[model samples]
Target chain A: MSKLNIKNLIKSFPSMDRPAVNNVNLDIESGELVAFLGPSGCGKTTILKMITGLFQPDSGDIILDEQSLLKIPTEKRGVVMVFQNYLLFPYMNVNENVGFALKMKGVDKNIIDQKVKEMLELVKLPDIGLRKPKQLSGGQQQRVALARALISNPRILLLDEPLSNLDAHLRDEMRDLIVTIQQKLKVTTIFVTHDQEEAVLLADKIALIFDGELQNFTSPKNYYEKPKNIKAAKFFGGVNFINAKKHNDNLSTNIGTIHYKGENYTDLNEDNIITIRPENIKLSKNNDFNNNSFKGLIKSVIFSGTHTRYKIIVNDLELECSLQSVGLQDIKTDDTIYVHLPSDKIWAMNE
Target chain B: MGGERLKIILSLTPPLLIIFTLFFGGIFYGFLQSLGYQPAIGKYEINFSAYYNVMFSERYAKLFWTGLGLNLWVSFASTFLAAVFALFGALAIRKTFFAKTICNFIYSLNLPMPHLVVAVGIIFVFSQSGLLARFASQIGLIGSPGDFPVLVKDKYGLGIILAYIWKEAAFFFIILMSVLQSLGENFEELAQSLGANRWQRFRYVILPLVMPNLFSASIIVFAFSFGAYEVPALLGVIYPQMLPVMAFEFFLNPDLNARSEGMALSIIIAIIVMILVVFYFWLTQAKIRKD
Candidate 1:
């Protein structure tokens, strides 16, 4: 059996008649770090709770390591959930909080101490056992929380927006620490976040969800490069769209005639939608270029440190593009310029 | 003739005049009376004897000790239990459960219905010849009210404990739920992942995050339980009456001199409660510093 398998998981709050988590299914490999990526309120946390047995599924089967996990209590699920806020016990020192699970399982004191110490070291917070959670900073609290969860040596780890609390720099540090800990432990992990970049950076596989529906389950590269829907396409930063119309054979877009790279859809016809990446659009000083090029005025130029972003207006089409700051001419606002779109790079999408 | 502060002093005149007349008047009146020279009471003789005599009396000692004991027991018991129940109740309802909806509904039922209603409810349930007695009799254990086991108003103080627990715990629970809920679900989930069990999660995660609220709720609980009159008077036993009951009895005594003695007893109760409040504040501050 798969390390973790969820089939038709569902949950609903009392205020609503509909389920927050509706007919969700996921299959996790033994030690894969999977991310459930979605915007806020898309039921990612609800799914995490169901996996940990914190919330019982309205209807579903969860098989963990070849055994049905439906009847398993949270304590017995062997999956630890790391929360966004890092809820650590106020009463106990770090060591006591980390060692608590062993104490409940009737482990010996010496063994518990050894395990706690090892887990602490794994989180790289050695000899800080006596310190309470309130004594630790946001990052340290996060690491101690990680240590406490890993101390049980569970088969799977569930993290729900764990790094969203910290400042940007600390968030990066904690994410790296969590990744390092997960690598060493080899435990299957389900990390949930709305941040697409985080999902791309961390997960072995990313599940892109939108409006409580599974949009697509694929690798980060595939999910980013080849999005299944407009929502997923927009989730990655660089996508831009322009006017397009399809004819017989090749599609006719404002960029030029581009052959479709995606699967041919039965619903596709002469009227179609075109998608282009902002990075793929090339700009030049040559107004003489014909077919794929358009003469436009720079409506606005924004300096964004590493790269400059430009909003270009050409006839009826207004497009946004970002360019490398190096060796690029400083085009003033409303200056006439030539923007080129390569036919291969613009995908004509059929609705 | 002014350091540019004259306008500020002039601006303060209306409110300060009212406060000075009202507040300081009471203080100065009390000060004069405590010295045994109350012109309004017709004891204009400036004497130290009334103060001297009252200070050395055995009755004052009884009043002081009784107030001290009741304040300590009621405040400590109610505060400790209210905090524990609030923490557990918040955690229990944080996730959906079978009885969570109903329990939460009851926990949020009107709080200011006077402690007397709760005490009466406690009496109905726990008193001999009550529902428990009827059940016991039907089970062939007892024939009548006399044979029924005693619980409410018993010398053991179980009735008062139950009444206080029922009312104050729910009070604290409301405040604590907001605090715990506001802290959000992330912190606790993180703790669970850390290998902490249900109990450990409370100890390490929920407790720390909710401590400030818990401390504030306990202080309110302590204050109310320390000065509590209705519940203990109605449901509490008679032998060593609770501080408030004693203070009330003295205030009601027919003898005119006893009114002064009653005020003295109340003063004692007030002092004791204040001391306890200061102590609880100190303890929490120390704990925070340690953390």
Candidate 2:
């Protein structure tokens, strides 16, 4: 059974012409970690707010554990959220901040102390309980905020761009910490973020939102391999899109006749496009594949540290291909190359 | 760096000179007069007789003590009540855009109005023969004008306190509105998400977050109300007056020696306010450090 269900949630602001969150629906299982992934102003956070009761949806229901959560107040809903800026109580010390929820419940002081100690240890800041929040580093403050939220043992934990404020190294560290702690606790968690890599790395399932609508909700691999639409594919960094017409079992595009062994697309709209990831498009000196192969001219070569991205033009259609730079021959601009689009890697979607 | 320092000092010289010569120089001359160094009366001998006469002399001891008590009561009551009213006012209006704008404008309308004007308005509205009294009599809540309770010019200094609250609540509201606006609702929402109810959120988050600014604003209001003479002079009773009003009375005396006593009273008022402000800072800073 699902632990939380958001059904047809919609919210609109008077100043905005469109609803901030428009009919978003999801069923998050117990102990599952989900990520609401989108760009800024895409209403991912709005959905989280509605779940926490910070915002009231205009037209739908949020059911948690088979109970309607609309009638319950925020404090009683047992849903905790960690903000991006780590809104730790500025006036409380670290120990007080972590144990604040328990203290509010009139929990025993000794138990609160023991639990705070454990939480501090969990977040790996055991000795900084006496320090003020402002005294901690940005990463440490976020850790403390996470500990504070987890100490309460909420039914659903929501994090809003928790790692966005950290530097590159700290972001990686915090990401690892979040995964470790979340798996250990086995608590249902949902986080909102714009970074695709963070969502893919942290979430069991990623819900992609665009313009206040749910674009796709599936595993991260599915997003990269079988996105629901062009927007979803584009958002997941799909750069090579070829306008194609699907016949019985293959797609005919400007580049070539693409042989794809996938689900039948008879019910799909006539305006269909085939997309393949840049990294999946194979580049070699000669034709190596019997199907979906084409000769292309390399228009540009961008050698980023780990990979070389090439903009190749084939049959008047531009295609991007990313190749590993470790053992490659000296590939430069204007080089003629053979591009192969693997049958299994080609994803077809309506325009 | 040296040239920049010289430039800053040169730019600051005019205001510094004005403050030192006009403000501190006047205070220094007052201190001299308070110690009985009145060259105008051919009494150049500096002594503590004027302070003794004002504080310990039988003719003025009762007056001074009662005036001091009234001053403390009025200042503390007005500052506390105004702060509480303004806090609730700011909280109530902070969330609504249209209402907040209108209420904020109306609340701050009193900020620039003169204290004397507010005192006079209080008199017209709350005095025995005032508008409220006449309305109450006409509505049969009271028998006549004389039946109305004496709110202005009463022994409890209620009128003076009311005037201060009216003027100073606006000052506090302005400060608190800005503070609450800058803080936004992130802290409160965080507390709420942490299972804190409305009262708990206010107690733990909102109150503590605004305490430092509120304390500073309170200090200003307290000091001003304690030392200001106009409101109390316009609204106070004759016998048990506020310290400022009583201090001003001494200056009206025809005797040249009485001028020293007036200056002594003024110096005492200033010293008391300074001590109270320092004590307030110490108390709040200790709490802040503990937190």
Candidate 3:
């Protein structure tokens, strides 16, 4: 494990008006497994490529242990990447592919063989050493790619959406396998993913990127609960954006005036907005629960397996609230329910 | 089932019939002639005298042997050199922006040029009395044009080999460029990340992936260069000619019996090319299966 410092990295393609990776900076600690989480074309992959020296930054410095990597070529930098499609060498079988790096470094045949065998056993595919990549399943090929990248004992490992190509069940299994291998190897890894759930599951810290900038770089719990902006909040799922007027400690919206504790709002002139996730809004029949409770009519009910999604209308504001489906079978459309918005849960942001 | 079979045969008959008549008919007639049956010269008996005469007879045996040797050398050298040069050229210009387009245009520009024109072009530029030799004399590189080296019409068949390499390198370039473009840079990039240098990546990853196409394209260039008569006939020494040139001379003889010998020599060249292509295909297939 090694520390990777990316300072002021910027890259732009000739055909694109905006830079592909705009002035991005990240400091990865030793033995940390961080995920660059964002939607497609959000510059997550670009950041990973820049770190691995596959794509050169227009101007910036990538330092590993205080040593700048700008002068180093890709193969000499000891930074390996497992591409999104698992780009295994078609001419080589699994053993040769995994042992390619050691062989290139002029390792002995017996040592390369031993290391390749160890990698295959670590990846749990000890019997597939002689099978070509095309003959392996997508999951098996992904394992081979991981084995190949990790066999070199690289300073930093980069995974470019490695689980995007597998089926749902295989993706779950591969996710577990990757995390286990990552822990066992303890290599400082930066996993680029667009899937929020996968990011939450694997990353010790997640860097949420959007439009070539880091929106939020924090733990998965904080990133999900307290996103930096509306765009980051909307990435998780249904989020309600309320145009509200701030009055000292309270904000007035179309639904009702609620308690506001965030510091962004100052006066009536400020464009204060209150955003809350659907699962944060509690559905109740009693009105004496909280100061932010309001009576709303249930507009529609979507019966998901784990929870019941209710579209409620309060005044002119249409709101979505999900309640766990424990005994909510009696609830139907047009039922009047009191919705509670917690004072701390409502994130206030200035537009 | 019978109706479907009839429909399949009907769909296949046009091309199959044309191929059989043109290909099999030619082979049959050539084989019969090689067996020494020529009614025009009133030799109606079937025998292998023409094949024997071409191989061992005192009159043409030395000429035939030397021609075969020159034929093999020129074809093998030119094909191997062309394929190697084309592979490097394609790799160098595979991803550049301006140079890629310009080099592709220039590379393909030579494809439509005939072998006869290329051979004449080589003679015009490389001969002792040619433009380059005269230019060297004027520039004081040589005292006179006669001081220029003998590159054209030399006994080593250098002129013929140079002509084929110039023309057919473009041919192999077209084949290799398409293969490299389709294969893309993803694998090579992965190899680089896996600690492979540029030369290592080309040798292990790029070369192996493109080998099958290169081999197939080489077989085509080899077969053409081996049997092509125009390039060598125009730029070859008379003493040690290529096989096709010798065969053409046999056809040019007034004796009708010589026609059988010419057909027999042509058949021999074709059989050699067929065997080589089949062997290369089998070798590549076995290597692919083993891995």
How well does each candidate superpose onto the true structure, as a TM-score? 0.73, 0.96, 0.95
Runs of candidate 2 exceeding 4 Å displacement? A264-267, A329-332, B1-17, B281-291
| DockQ scores of all models, one per candidate | 0.29, 0.76, 0.78
Q: Which sequence of candidate numbers ranks them by TM-score, best first?
A: 2, 3, 1
Give the Å shift of residue A295 in candidate 2: 2.9
Candidate 3 per-residue C-alpha lDDT over B231-256 given as tens digits, one digit per residue, 9 for 90 to 100: 99999999898889988888999987
Clashing pairs in 3: none
Ranking by DockQ: 3, 2, 1
Query: TM-score of predicted model 1?
Result: 0.73
Residue A155, model 2, lDDT: 94
Weakest 10 consecutive residues of candidate 3 chain A by summed lDDT:
A262-271
lDDT of 2 by residue, B1-291 (tens): 999999999999999999999999999999999998988889899899988988899999999999999999999999999999999999999896766678889988989999989999999999998999999999999999889998999999999989999999999999999999999998888889899999998899999989999999999999999999999999998989888888888899888788999999999999999998899979988976775
Off by over 4 Å in 1: A8-19, A22-25, A91-93, A97-106, A109-117, A124-135, A238-276, A281-351, B1-110, B114-142, B145-170, B183-271
Ranking by lDDT: 2, 3, 1
Error of 1 at B279 (Å): 2.8
